[model samples]
Target: MKIIYRNNDRYAIKKLLLDIGEPELERECWRRKLHKPRRINLFFLETNEGITSLKYKYPQKGVETIIDVSQYDLPECGWIRYKIPY
Candidate 1:
């Protein structure tokens, strides 16, 4: 999911947890360093060939950012890039 934050191009990569749901809240996170939380509603892209064995744990600290989908520990076959603000 390409997010447009401050009109900058940044990317994040993570494994897809579940199939994209209907128009709903996208992944979100909070940063204590900045003192505020960030939320975004990303569109649902198709679920293509993904890493079956490779798994990813969700962020607990609440750090939301654009995802690059290719940086997962498993070299699965999913790709996503999101635009975000720091």
Candidate 2:
């Protein structure tokens, strides 16, 4: 797992997990915290996945943060990849 910290920490987790490839996704978990500079955390449901922590200012007054998480089950390869979008 890759953990990235950014001034806009909200996008860090999303950037970290986007590499994972998933077929479909269901639920999501989100959090806002009081850290050095404030941030957001998100966890995707239906895949037992979690985005540990994020530190970013909620969009001041712009477009919402768009995040997409998915799950891919490769029966033949015996593996599952979860793709989290930023």
Candidate 3:
């Protein structure tokens, strides 16, 4: 699967998966976390299948935290991607 983050371009899961065993992808993920702004807001993930999920992430005490939406009936997409601005 692929995602278009912040309108930059679509990125495949291979480019963003943390457990993919790719050093460059891991570095890119870190770079994104570092560059992402620290704010409380909603983020959207839209899939090619027309399913959308809402999420949020922030830093808490030096650790990155994500607002859990696991209770919601999100579609079984392979992974989360495509950060839409709120």
Q: Which candidate is the best by lDDT?
A: 3
Would you list the C-alpha lDDT of every candidate in the order shown? 0.28, 0.30, 0.35
Tens digits of lDDT, candidate 3, 3-84: 4422111242222222234464345446556434333232333334453322233444343322222333443444535644
TM-scores vs. true structure, each candidate: 0.18, 0.19, 0.22
Candidate 1 residue pairs in clash (backbone atoms < 3 Å): 3-83, 12-67, 12-68, 13-68, 13-69, 29-62, 30-62
* Model 3 lDDT, residue 52, Cα: 34
Error of 2 at 9 (Å): 2.9
The local lDDT score (0 to 100) that residue 57 gets in candidate 2 is: 35
RMSD of each: 12.4, 13.2, 12.2
- Model 1 agreement with the true structure over 23-70: per-residue lDDT tens digits: 211332122122222222222222223412211222464333323333
Better of 1 and 2 by TM-score: 2
Encode model 2's per-residue lDDT on 1-86: one tens digit a residue. 53332232334344444443222111122322222222335322222244322123344532233233333221122123554555
For residue 22, model 1's alpha carbon misses the true position, in angstroms, by 34
lDDT of 2 at 13: 40
